[model samples]
Target: MSSRQRLFTLMYRVGFAPWDGHPLPQALRDLVEGSAALPAGTALDLGCGTGDSSIYLAKHGWTVTGVDFVAKPLDRARAKAATARVVVEFERADVTRLSTEAVGSNFDLIVDSGCLHGMSAEDRDAYVREVAAVAAPQARLLIVAFIPGSSFGVPGIEPDEVKQRFARDWTLLSSGDETAMNHNGKNPARQYLFQRAV
Candidate 1:
């Protein structure tokens, strides 16, 4: 099975997910609320595990499309959206092979929370290209991932790696190391953010 399928199976077997945290990331909320008053035109949440970020964006007035390859997580995401009474379009698809036709159209903002870290180098390249293709010229991209100092099996991606992968098509908007207390309450991970070049 593909890595995406493996993730779905794992989540299906486990009754609860490790990453489903209450409340949106403070950093992301601050950025989205502070950037401008205009509602975002279109937004894509790639690898949107359980749709926390997607739901948050929708609540904040951005029309959101969440894509993940996992079925169980998508179900949970749909339920969460229904509970929150927000409208979101959720799809089951692999990010590595994502196409605009599949996503329906381009977007003005894209968020990937720890999605790219699990991908191999080649897949990461392709993922970036695909995302670029679906983003507008001035699109804002928010990415959150584990950095190298984190524990093993945590998909620890280095800052330099992010720079090398995204610099060609995106400009660094605001990036810094920040920790998030996981649902387990012991582990924390780093996050980074960027914006598509104008």
Candidate 2:
């Protein structure tokens, strides 16, 4: 296992991953419920800790797949899906190196609640490539990440980076405020909407 995977595993095993229990942010829910971009189709939830977001999508008639690297959280995610009576395919996957073999060939919608910010610049580029590879035509990418901030050690991804990385293939639809909290208070989140080029 990669050291990054080990770190996340330890975080989950020792109860340091507090984001595991957060409910779907209201803004995200509103966007998903109101936007035409996300219809009832296949959904991929990256960093789907405990499968809450996956379960949410499955319950809404979307065939959902939740991917995380840690087995402990994936087990919990599976249990949650079982209890919720929703079928969310839970897989152990590294976000930095996602492939069609690991996550399937095409997904209609992809949601990254907190993973993209956590990735390094190189990993983020890999992530963009993987997203481009797997996204279906007219697919939508919804990202909730912390904008650059004073929170030391937290992944503070810049909006310009996201734009520059995805400029070729994705058209930014909009960006707005969010209340989702990371390790820090309030998180100062920015929810971005993107559509794959036709």
Candidate 3:
């Protein structure tokens, strides 16, 4: 297993996951409602914790792939998808290095749920590049992340950082505060909608 995968495996083994795995976030649930309008092509869920988002997409008739670095969550994700009666291919993958070889390419939609903010600058840029690699031109991306200032120091990312990183290849369509349930007494966040530039 990769080092990052080992670390996250330890985190899960030690019962230290900081995010909720029970209910689907409001932002995600809302997104699913529009699945009809989305391309029936592939949809990817980055850092798909326990497979909820992937299952939702599969249920809506989209081909879904859920990727995460940790094996533990990916295992749970598979189980949950089975329980939900939806087929979601869960792969243990590092988003920063996600490749066409592993998950295929030209995805029609991508969703990032609290994944981008915690990455290092290099990995964040790498994530954007990988997204571009897998995404079809004009594909849609939705990001929900812990906005800067919701908490103090380390692992938080500002809106500008995201915009600047994706600016070269993506056009920001909208952004706003998100109401996804926060684990620690109202962890403030925002969501951004973008379309890949032609």
**Candidate 3 Cα misplacement greater than 4 A, ranges:** 1-4, 34-39, 149-154, 182-187
lDDT of 1 at 45: 91
Tell me which of candidates 1 and 3 scores higher on TM-score: 3
In the order shown, what is each candidate's alpha-carbon RMSD?
A: 2.7, 2.3, 2.6
lDDT of 3 by residue, 49-158 (tens): 78777888898889999998877888888888888888888987888878843986788889987788777777887898999989988898989887766754337688
Local distance difference test, candidate 1: 0.77
Runs of candidate 2 with Cα error greater than 4 angstroms are 35-37, 150-152, 180-187
Reference-based lDDT, residue 75, model 2: 95
What would the per-residue lDDT of candidate 2 be over residues 89-183, giving only the tens digit for each residue? 99888776678447885788889987888777787888999888888988888888877773444677888887888899999988776655534
Residue 187, candidate 2: alpha-carbon lDDT: 56
**Candidate 2 TM-score, true structure as reference:** 0.91
lDDT of 1 by residue, 1-198 (tens): 677568656866686455566446556776678665435678999888789999988998899999987788899899999999999999988787677448755688888877787777778888988888888888888787766656545566788888788899899877765545353654445556677886
lDDT of 1 at 2: 78
lDDT, each prediction: 0.77, 0.81, 0.80
Task: Identify the superior model by TM-score, candidate 2 or candidate 3.
Answer: 2
Candidate 1 stretches with Cα past 4 Å from truth are: 35-38, 179-188
